[model samples]
Target: MPRRKKTFLCGHQGYGQICHRCDQTRTQREKADHARAEKKQKKQEWEAAFAQDPIDLRDLPDHVVVKARSIIAGLMTNTNYRDFGGKRLRHNRFIISIPVTRNYRMLCRDCGSFLVPEEVLSHEEYNVCKPGG
Candidate 1:
């Protein structure tokens, strides 16, 4: 008896003596081995990272979403956002533009003089004197 020459298409194992010709069995095994190795490598990398506690936000990728002073500076000059009425309220990540003023005229019931709206927003209290008194 003599040891025979053998070629392996898959795994480390060699086919038996009668396996000299090619067959589907060899191809299937080789494909399976390749898929298994890929799966194992992915699993090892995943486990190595996932085993530790996740990083906090402070340890996240260094990205400055916004420099605070720069943002404040931008906001300071962004007055065009104000409505024609001179009022602005932001809510829900949206600018809520409510009319700060509308056409309004006021007459002194006592003095018969007209008063502007700007004076009204600041007065807090008013006592218009009558002409006769």
Candidate 2:
């Protein structure tokens, strides 16, 4: 079988004479620019017809930060010091409200036995996890 000969366009080894197609595409792109702006303006007009909810930063509750830390701590058990949001958390950085509550699913500091939340030894008692006080 004869090996097919390769062709070049506009001196381009990949698509030699196809440079005319590239020029045609460029011309079409410029022609579409005006329509693109019109479409953008129409989209803005449609969006302006609706009302968006505004974030009330001052309305944030005090428990939000602590609750967030607790949730993140739970995530840390599986994730390596990384929060559920993919943010790296420092060892000492977290909510300190959750006391050593006995958790039936939690393991002991020395032993791998599960204890209740109220019975689970917290950082203050077992010095195991230092996430919360």
Candidate 3:
């Protein structure tokens, strides 16, 4: 094949040169900068959503401290945590009080009758009442 003439925007790749390699490098640099910016933005949003409370491990119960440490480790490694409207997690970090009589049999204050706490627990326990006949 006969040699076709090629052209260069600059004589020896100096300033103002629009070479293929330079264009690719510029594109890669732009992509990298964009990704870094996105990561930074995500970090800021996450920080805003959750404020970390610093608790002295020494002041906490040994088991509580151990569980907290494990959760921290999971967060640091980006695993083992799920968001439940920011209320609950896979682990019970907060206490959930279930309404129940102190014993299986208890006096119903309303009717003064001995009653067994319901087997199924629910918020309805708050309205527990009996007709004082």
Candidate 4:
């Protein structure tokens, strides 16, 4: 004998005991909800991490933030600023500029023995902040 399609209360016809169409849609919606929740959790974690940083890196791009953190870690370990291709600002000898990326720079203050991270700025911002750009 052959099986027959039956209409479920959802008004969907299928061979199964439950309406496969509604079930599929429900499953997809659950999966999407799960994914959205996961993404939100990750975003929260990312935001929380900024509190631990010595400088405010919230406005920088992801890659620039990572690079700046690495440089900050290196500086904390007594690494030489020159090793990171950093140079003292011509106008302000106490201020050191480290290249976080081609378009971004991390400024630090020379605190006698170690460097204190100040801020991360884009090329345009850096230029504008200089005495003569």
Best candidate (score: TM-score): 4
lDDT of each residue in 1-133, candidate 4, tens digit only: 7999999998889997799999999999999999999999999998999999999999999999989999999999999999999999988899999999999999999989999999999999998888222
Better of 2 and 4 by TM-score: 4
Per residue, candidate 1 scores C-alpha lDDT tens digits across 49-78 of: 433322111221222111212222333455
Candidate 2 per-residue C-alpha lDDT over 1-133 given as tens digits, one digit per residue, 9 for 90 to 100:
6544445554533333356656787899988997899999987864553222121112223344234335434634543322233221233222222321232112212112221112223334345554334
Name model 1 segments beyond 4 Å from true: 1-22, 51-133
Clashes (candidate 4)? 0
Q: Which stretches of candidate 3 lie over 4 Å from their true place?
A: 1-17, 51-133
Best by lDDT: 4
Q: Looking at model 1, which ten-residue stretch has the lowest summed lDDT?
A: 114-123
RMSD to truth, every model = 21.7, 16.4, 17.6, 2.6
Q: How well is each residue in 58-105 modelled by candidate 3, as lDDT tens digits?
A: 433344444544444443464323421112212332311222222111
* Model 4: residues with Cα > 4 Å off, grouped in runs: 131-133
Q: Tell me the lDDT of model 2 at 60.
A: 25
Query: Using lDDT as the measure, what is the rank order of every candidate, best first?
Result: 4, 3, 2, 1
Error of 3 at 5 (Å): 6.4
Ranking by TM-score: 4, 3, 1, 2
Model 2 segments beyond 4 Å from truth? 1-9, 12-20, 50-133
The lDDT of model 2 is 0.37
lDDT of every predicted structure (CA atoms): 0.32, 0.37, 0.38, 0.92
